[model samples]
Target: MSTTISRLLVANRGEIAARIIRTCRTLGIETVAVYSDADRDAAFVQLADVSVAIGGEAPADSYLRSDVIVAAATQAGADAVHPGYGFLSENAEFAQSVIDAGLVFVGPRPQTIAAMGSKIEAKRLMADAGVPVLPSAELDGLDDAAVQAAIDGVGYPAMIKASAGGGGRGMRIVSDPSDVLEAVAGARREADAAFGDGTLFAERYVAPSRYVEVQIFGDHDGNVVHFHERECSLQRRHQKVIEEAPSPSLDPTTRTALHEAAVRAGSALGYVNAGTVEFLLAPAVGAGSPEFFFLEVNTRLQVEHPVTEAILGVDLVALQLAVASGGALPDQAAIGAPRGHAIEARLYAEDPAAGFRPSIGELRSFAIGGPAHAAVRVDSGLAGGGVVSRHYDPMVAKVIAHAGSRDGAARQLAGALRQATIDGLVTNRALLVRTLQHPEFLDGRADSAFFERNDPAALGAPLVDGPDVAWYAAAAALAVQAYRRSTDRHTAGVSSGFRTVPTGPQRIALVDPAGHEHRVSYRF
Candidate 1:
């Protein structure tokens, strides 16, 4: 294959940028990085072969600004641009600009992007391709009168979604007819804020549905293949919190049909590189199998890519680069079915008890490597010394545990999370651990609406007596005090002067995000 580009400019920040850079380096491609003022000292910037400052911290002024990104690429003298998800990854105009500037976009054509970028338009396209989709209503006109007319056609309990937006930023659900206007307005505001497009669409809010998505890869020659499905049913606020490969709910027949549906959807757009075909799966009714419908196509590598990679034993990021360089996808016949079971839990720097709000703080201490009992794999963006910032998504890492069976996978994931420790910035690790242990989840009875109905505090922090993880900090603090006392008496530091902190007869006060403190004493 002839190479059109040797240097690639990554037009995003944080972990995704770092991910792309790693692949580019392995392929002998020089890389350039862009960062904002807030991320001037970011790890990605320092690691890149070349780095450029874009603008201020907020995504709008920096990463999302097309001009800044393109200018950075040009100034960095890169021949290709890779939009590493979240910022400009799915923006058709951004893709067009890269092509117009004579730089390889490392993705699909601009027209293809424009086609699938809209939720309503994409649904229509998929439906034409014989892919089932949920009920939809396009906001043909933005006026109140037109919305009312559209709602009457789509029916009640519909979601108002931003056609060009993602990450659950511009969406609202109206269970009652009276709240349609408020939903439309709020959705538009969020859409405009997030994607600079206020065009909204309506789709039926399917109840008891699971978020099942298939990873897809296509080349310029029109060849397409499915990388199987990942169950992203576990979500919070429409954002996926946990994902697993080879959906346990799908049988062989359903899996084949689902994969075929995803391939057809990808073929419709002439998609290239890696993208995900999100579908909504409704529960079985009466005697029939469950019905699945195309939801939306994520036009970039997903945050949950690790789960897919873990089960398939392939590096998707590397594959993406290969596709961009005009290389053929790994032979469809060469790829086997997913091996074993894989589960992923996103570790977010947020307080689960306080409504799972975003948190920002410097990490004081951290440890993630386990004893290899569960085939644990951690794809993280932070080292122990990094800071969790408010300027980006709160997800710090994705911990995946692979095993021979679903039950083993679940238990292994829980074990990995339990053994993991982070000192600074409250996280949802405990909640994820609890969800892994949740009866409904373990039995595969949970769906996309599971978190919406369950209490947030209950998922990560179960009511059961958890191993006092925080107790270690207090014991260590007290142990240090004891060691100092010994040193004070001896007037010298010695190995014998240190005493291991015991869990017996220790008490400490722990504070919740709400400023409520509880005294937790320990007894050994």
Candidate 2:
């Protein structure tokens, strides 16, 4: 039952929407972009062959409105819908709605999504499929005593997680028995607010572990293959900050075992399309092999898919479209081995000095400098004169670098980030550059707690400081004075900065990215 998608609708925004459009253009598929009020003039909207206004700025009124999105697709004459990564990508009901509307849903079967959507149920299914999983207990509708008992069963230092969602929401780690009830109540409220489902579960917490995941793809013809693994240990609050392929931490045996486990997990679910099987690898003690436990499965393409694509020389979104159209999986041998090392750093609009608070404003100037080569790539949704609204995720771009070795990739990525010119909003670019060059990160020992062990203030400190700041401020003041003089018609003959009566030196104040104020005084 193969059907061609002549016109496809992208049900997402930002860099991902732009990324999908690139693939569609190469494949000669016409694209329809759905936008909110905030994204009416976005890059993706301008790139699409057709555009539709869905709703307001908020996600509830826009991207998450499944009915509205499906109707937009129908109205735009789109035959397929690609839900990029976030919002309703993993929502089974949304997938069903796309299917019911007689449009292709470029993802897994609705049953598979429903089965793996719940952490509790997914863990049970994985355990049944012989994949290693941590001990966990369901806490929905349980009394305080029962909740405590469940926590005791899962052991101390348990994590209370929202069963219905991911992205670090509705998650709280409790080490003390006294905090169990409060943690549960708070997690429930947060989960209800975020996902409309307060169902929760508790799992044993593992510290000093590596966060690794396997990229798997399946087709309708009952075949599943892995694109190796990615190390995502560099994180903040469980959100991935930097990701690299062919984890430097794993030996051959562990790596093979992880890939096999991932394939088995996907096969068990009869999965179709692109998905990731995440795992936590515990540190080995003495001569024993390190043990890996299944985390959760993401039912859509990951944000870090570029790193995988870089190393494998493949297009995951293209493959996703092919599989969605009833195509068969490529031969396992044809997929081949990873060619080189690739690392991706997420560039976000946040003030690292202010505890990573989201920054919003017009992007007065935004440019990421690097050779437009396959070795170094930047996927972004914004440019000069664009607005970073407060209604959406603050990720501005993903900068990726590929080289023959890990050190080479890291150095290249760091250099590219250093050359980027981003103004008008605070970002984590400094922190990303510092982390890429950090000794522990370079040696591949940095874990999920890398930020906890290192001082972010020190890492995120501006590269320019001390006497150098004063020199730059002086230059800027001079440039401003020159510009004003050149533009002022009445002062053309005043000889610039001239005063009939001598007075104090002219003063100008400027603020640096770190919020430090510099006062420059000069006289002509």
Candidate 3:
């Protein structure tokens, strides 16, 4: 409450930055955007009232440079800083810097970020606060003897997670004791690359696990409320592909218990603004019956916030602004009433069938055709034809569907995806549609193993261009030949374009991704 916060600085890029910008504009708050050299002309930059060029192309020189961001905020005369997901959002040091600079950090307190930024520290804090935690122990002198002793106790399937890493980095699953050392070394190297810390810990690799996370909000007035859970089961690597509100597997009693746990955890931290409590749920495991154990706290808005917004009709970004500015949380009984079902599909410009390799190119054409009802909404940061660069994440847009039931919402999302078209860049849109329509998915039986169990090529349309179009092109070529050849003796080389009834043969070569050519030959 010490600062008035009339102006705010968005300290990230892409769709999330634009998302927060929209909310700020609605609140009559002036917005300032910080951009790297590459993102100087990004949509979020244009949408902001003002923009600052912080550094060069690299994230470290730009987005991750806390000092640069703080200086930019100071120069822009912004009263608050909103680190929209990723980058420096979870860095407690960055939060502290913003505070020292006399600007409100529109997120959890610095202490909360520090406590949760490190997975080891967060686990210990949760255990100390009586939150349900998984079976795990920190590794300190992880030599051969130590590894053997710990692995024997933790069992065959264990996870080696980075003490100071997240977002899918620095984590490896060891199904056999023999692979522990190698996996641990790889995890340590990845952790060093990401967090400058190579330290790791061992934890029971929860089986049949679902990434269930709770949305919670707190204010300076000490009031906190839970907005239900999201089931992020369908993920590639550790990136979430599909997310739904109110996890399908949870019963009424379990849902209440989970919410209570989240509230208690948040109250324990004196958390403020918007945050998510992630849990590793090994449903039907002994000791815990389809229950969730505390994983970590994301002390900022999550990328999948729209699902919660759709189900609860709450604008979390706005809530963050209000809470950061000393406003009290809304009446819990009235605000926590979640209705309807919401589903979100992240339409990334990646080729899932191609080892999920990142595809970067110009979007020749992009259009999303969906139901014109209020229940359907498509949030995007790109125009019809924007360039997708390797410099950033491949996500172009998020398509969300809201309905009265899970099946309805899911079907709505599939139909919307089917009508979408993008010409140039390779995307997993078709794959998403296939996943949504898969029999197992429709029946709510999809798990993390679903993709591996199914055929990748069959997961989407076989060709980048629809099967019908390819066949249509071929049929059109055949028809042209059929019309000219009266005897119907036309072959690949003896095409309809043989104006003088050619005596020789001609071949047309078409190259494919595998560097092979298919030659169509005909003789006239």
Candidate 4:
């Protein structure tokens, strides 16, 4: 039954919504965009064929309102809905609501989502399917002594994780026995607040490990295939920052084993559409083979999906739409070996030196220039004069580069980022450039603890400092004066800085991204 989706509604906002609209255009599907008050005039909203205001500014009032989103889809006459990687994407109830409304949901079935939504249940399911998983115990209704006993059984340095959600929320790392009960209670409260489910579980925490995941896709025909792996070891606050394909740290044997394990896991769940099987890889030690453990399965597309698409040379969103329409999966042989290496850096509007605090303001300038060869790609929803709202995630863009070699890709990406014209908001662009060019990262020795070992303030320091600031400030002041002179009605024919009487050099004070002030004095 190959039913076509003539019209599709994107139930999210920002760059991901724009990304989905692009694919829908390519597939000849009419697109509808649903937005909140904050995104009423956003780029994604303008890009869609039709736009609808779902509710107010907050996520709960807009993007997370499944009923409103479904109503908008019906009102817009859209046949399907695409939850683009964020709010309500993994909510099984939301998915069921879409299905119940006689609309196609562009993701896995509700049952599969529910099964994998809980980390405890997902691990049990993986273990039963013969997938390697870390030792863990469920702590939903356990007493104080039982909880401590479970933590002791899982060993020291155990991680208490929220069973119902991801994104590093409701998680605590416990090393001391005295902190077990407190950590558990706090995690429970956070989980309840974040996901409305306080159920939790304990698992052994792995340190100095590489975070790798396999991109898997399944179709309605019960076929699943792996699109190799991505190395996402570089992180902050348990969130991925930089990701690359064909992990530089994995040996050939380990890579093959990981792909097979991911395929097995997906098959066990009968997973459909795009999903990622994440794993924690412990590097080989003294002639021993590297060991990998199934971390969890993200039952929806991941944020770092662009790196996989670049290496595989496929549009995952297109494939997702195709499968959602009851199409068959592409043959494994057709989706051949990876062509080259690709790396993606998340350019976020945050001050890394200031504890990664989100920075919000108008994007006075936002341009990313790359080589003429066109190996670089930037996926962003912002442009010059756009506002970065405080109501949503502060990620400004994702910059990706592909090259014949890993080093080439890193260097090319670094050059592109270094020469970018991003202004106004404080961002982690400098830190991304530093990580790409750092010796340890190039040698593939960097792990999830990379930030812990290297201070972000040092890594995110401005590329130019000292006297360069004075020169930049002087140039800015000159430009401002020139513009004023051009627009001034009183100084019709006068040149900039023209004065009838002798005077001291005009001074101007400016502030830099790091909150430092510089004074500039220039005569002409």
Candidate 5:
């Protein structure tokens, strides 16, 4: 019963694939990368010891082709497959296929994935395992009247959710009973389009709630460990934008209870490798403890895993490799108490002012630098010359900072983002910086609806680089011309900066970011 994986094939692309390859190299394991035509020259592919082209650019033709992936692994002689988050990471059939092909999958058992993949089934399982679950009514063969009765029982302000999918794809909030039928129908349609399942369910919508999740790891020995809690309250479009380790608002007692419940959920699934048990905490009433309800379980590594690693000084991917290789669970004492604070902001190639639409263009200049006094870590898949295409997710990079306290961490990250110079593509960098420095976010009072409550217009105003910015740009352009002239044999002795031709005053036409053009005159 050896769990050793000598050669690992990463079944993903982009930054996550690169992240896993880094851990694999550190662990002395040979790594293989699979890519579609669009990602053939991606950073992750270049970093892999061996790479194989799967198919065309689209996910369906490439990344989502489980059979093709297994074949590629076989050809590359990979002993195991590591499915990073997204794509096929949470797909139970893909995991089972890897197993069926006589290769190990670096995630939970297929049965565990299936059990938690569906919201309806996962809720029942959580409730059975003594975990606090939000009340939900199944919509299997229910008539309109029955559905209304169930909604009345759960009260108004209920959410109509698709039991088969997540990421807010098939979710609708029904405040009026008159809108219940339409909401349910809409949720089902969206669910079918996203996950190919139209099954719908109802749950009471909790507002003014905080999103908290516990990271859990388990081995084959039935031993499970919790990595405390992460406050993921800052969200937009039902997706988390900022995540931090060691929630600033949780008390010691509440933190302990959250960990215990997470452990219970993991133990019930007999989980393995890295997984996350998400929870929603209602606002505290008087002096009473905050009420928490199980949300769902992510059966793979999370994008914000770096925050947890920063607080605990642990490489979660390394731990996943060890556990998958039959290593014993990490000792409880060694897990230790989380230290300091960590914050992560996901930078995406999208315009926050325009309803967060994807921005596709070449990254003319992308530079991110931390202050000389702060600690910052940036994980990115694309480089300065890389193109942000319409074929994939709009995420460009993840900026994370660690400090001695929550405010310190938030401030550090905000400063780092503000100092970044990203041109030729609209991005959410400015918005992220504002969010990190906002009063509510700084005071730990920002909840899941922070963006909805706050005005995007005010928060996402364009950055003003001052009147000197244009002068600097002109100077840089002139410097480049001078260098090019010096490199040319015909003009090697000519100093382009000195205006050797003695022409009239030079007029440089420049276009501002708002599409306005202006002319500047200079003499040499």
Candidate 6:
């Protein structure tokens, strides 16, 4: 049976919600946005055709409450519900709940999500399907001695990860055998808090591996097509900061194999809608073929899908809607070859110099370029006066630049980020700019440990006010003094701080954004 949706309710918030709303508008479908109290005036809430207040600010009280979201969708007369990325986006139970409520869930089947939900199960399934998977062990059934044995079997520098949740939660790297138990415990706690499941697993950690993920789409008929790949090797804290399309590290043969493997993965599960299959590509040595191992499946649209969209010249959201509605995907040949290159930088409210700590405060000023011939495209859920509280992800905007070449794309994006005016809270804008210009990144050799290898201070150095900045401060102070002199009653007709001839030096104190005061001296 074909499922048709007229009005859709987006069961999430922030930029992804806004992103879905934009696509829905293009398709002439009305959108319903659910928001917490914290996002009452958020951009997505304002942009949606209708909006509902779900609950309090915390995710559990609001976004994670599946029943409440379903009720909101029903009340809003939405025929379908789209869980944008994050929150309940990859949740199998939530997807089932929506299906049970007779609303079309705009994503893969609940079974598909369940299959790929756990890292262990997904890897086993992929391995069974002739897909290469990293060696891993399920620790739930293993004793302490057995766990240590398994770790030793997998070798050192293995990763203990929470199989239930992603986003780097409940994850730890165990280099020493003595640290295994503590790492497992910590990962389980974090996993439980983040995903309500504390199931842990261990995987062989491959160093100097490139993180590349293929965007895939499947129809109800079992037809699946791959939408090329994205290079996401540049990351910090296990989260992607910068991503680009058409991995520079992959040759045509490897690229074709990657695409075929991704298609096999999707078809094996009867996958439907949009999903991503991430892989770790070890560089080829001495002209040998590169080795790629299955990482995990993100059973929903990825944050870095825009780069794929840019290169492929297709709207993935549109495809998601079509596939979710029981429509067929275009023929493989019609998808066309990828062209040029695209790069995306996630701008966050954080201080990279201070260990990338989240910065929360009002955005006194926010300015970015709109779409132009060759300009950057900014996707943001924030406005100039928006308050970036600690309630959600600190990402303020996603700036993407498309060009005819990889270097061109990187340069354009970096220039755009450097030109952006973001005030109030400290941001990682300068860090992103520096990363795009870094030689390692430019040469496409950046690995998962890129941040660990580079100096955070150097990355955020551009954000530092240089010595010449004092001149601007002094000039601003002088301008203010001039204005006061022009407005004062006693000094109305006289130029204050001005003598017929030059006199003693005048000292003007200016406060920097970091609250440092600089005294400028000048003789007039």
lDDT per residue as tens, model 6, 256-305: 99999999999898889999999999868898889999999999999888
lDDT for each candidate structure: 0.82, 0.91, 0.82, 0.91, 0.87, 0.87
For residues 1-524, write the lDDT of model 5, one tens digit per residue. 46778899999988899889998998899999999998877888999999999999889999999999999999999999999999999999999999999999999999998988988899999999999998879876789889888887888899888887688899999999989888888888899999999988898889979999999999998999988789898888788899999998788888989999999999999998899999999999999888999999999999999999999999999988888888887777889998999999999998777788889968877767645624698888876547776788988999899999988888888888888878778888888888998899988899988988887655766665678667765775565555666678885665544564677665666665446565666665
TM-score of 3: 0.89
Q: Which of the two, 2 or 3, has more lDDT? A: 2
lDDT of 4 at 42: 94
For candidate 6, the 10 contiguous residues with the lowest summed lDDT are: 368-377
Candidate 3 colliding pairs: 492-521, 492-522, 493-521, 493-522, 494-522, 494-523
Between prediction 2 and prediction 4, the one with superior TM-score is: 4
Please give each candidate's TM-score.
0.89, 0.96, 0.89, 0.97, 0.94, 0.93
* Best model per lDDT: 2
Q: For each candidate, C-alpha RMSD in Å?
A: 4.1, 1.9, 5.8, 1.4, 2.4, 3.1
Candidate 3 lDDT score at position 101: 99
Q: lDDT per residue, candidate 3, 1-524, as tens digits? A: 54567999999988898899999999999999999988876778899999999988878889999999999999999999999988999899999999999899999999999888788888888888788998887776768779767876887689889988587899999998878888888998999998999888888887667778999999887888888899888887888999999788677777888888888889999888899998876666575558678888888898889999999988889888888989888776877567999999999988766787888878877777645534577777676657776778888898889899888998889887777867677788888988888888888777766777876546754344545545544544464457546666536465455646466564455444434444455554
As a whole number from 0 to 100, the lDDT of residue 175 in candidate 2 is 97
Q: Which ten residues in a row have the lowest lDDT in candidate 4?
A: 366-375
Give the backbone clash total of model 1.
3
Off by over 4 Å in 4: 370-373, 486-494
Write down the TM-score for model 5.
0.94
| Error of model 4, residue 16, in angstroms | 0.4
Q: Which ten contiguous residues of candidate 3 have the minimum total lDDT?
A: 510-519
Error of 4 at 270 (Å): 1.1
